[model samples]
Target: VPPGEFIPVAERFGIASRLDRWIIRTALSRHGAALRSGALTLGFNLSAQTLSDPQLWDFVDNVIEETGAPHSGIGFEITETAAVTNFDAAEQFVRKARERRCRVSLDDFGAGMSSFEYLRRFPVDTIKIDGSFIEHITQSRFDREIVLAITSIARSLGCDVVGEKIEQQDTLAMLSDMGVAFGQGFLLHRPEPLERIV
Candidate 1:
């Protein structure tokens, strides 16, 4: 199932945090050497329920310590919507995560009404533009404008911009021209099994 469909269900059922914990443990453990050596950086998308879980980082730090990945070379991707759900908690979470040397990213950035609010407050290192805007960016003037605006705002705030769902070469070129620091989609790499990736 697509994460958009299942994540909400997992969140409602209080299983999201457990799932997140499992992902963190598995990722750090399996990729410890590369992460510790700063050869690779792994990013995990966290659910809103997981963000509110007070024990989340302690668990993460323990796993990091056990793996001996100091930089952790791990970044947490929290959707803008999730960060807004519990503002204070989210703020504290971002601060603590960064303090521990893990990078934080605000995912699906323009999808939220309070995108600017989070940018002003949260010390996230990056903001990922919503895929909705990238889907037809090559054809839509409006999409291009929005992407430009987001990239400009993010740059002004000292946060890097990441463009998602970049499928075509035109889209990739456009995003690079617009100053997006990263791109992720089937165009760059199709999803592969963990065994193959590791």
Candidate 2:
């Protein structure tokens, strides 16, 4: 199925929890060897609904125990909007994940409303500046300002900032100058089949 179709279908069928389980299970099953060997680390995106589900954490704990892979090898990315929508649950999820030594990142950090407030509350290790703010950042004064502000806030909060959709050298250079810790986009690397790496 196309990636876009999976969420709606899962929600409509009331199988979102099952879908989350399947995703985690699949990741562990597919990458168990590499993860155990310290050859690869895996990251997964958790939807707002999943973040609100404590059962998901239980499932993750079980997987960690079964695989014997270091919890630090797994990271979870939660979008700003999603985390803010259910702040309490997201906070709990973040704290619990951290307790297990898993890294948590706030994705699309500056795209949503009250991002700074969320940043203050969410104990994430990284914040990914929204791609909308990163695209054409060098040319658009507003975007550059937003990215700089987000980067500043992230830095103050002791979180690494990442610039997304950085498709130009000028933009990358601009982000580097702004103290962005990392960047992602076509200019750096394109998404490819995971099997290629495995």
TM-score, candidate 2, is 0.90
- State the lDDT of candidate 1 residue by residue for 58-111, as single tens digits: 888788889987654889898877887788889999999888878899998888
Clashing pairs in 2: none
Candidate closest to the true structure, highest lDDT = 1
Looking at candidate 1, the ten consecutive residues that score lowest on lDDT are 189-198
TM-score of each: 0.93, 0.90
lDDT per residue, candidate 2, 1-198, as tens digits?
A: 665688878766877667877888888877887888888988888777788887887789888788777788899999876677688998899889889889899888778787777667778898888899988787899988888887887888888888888899988888998889799899998778778867
Off by over 4 Å in 2: none
Best by TM-score: 1
What count of clashes does model 1 give? Answer: 0
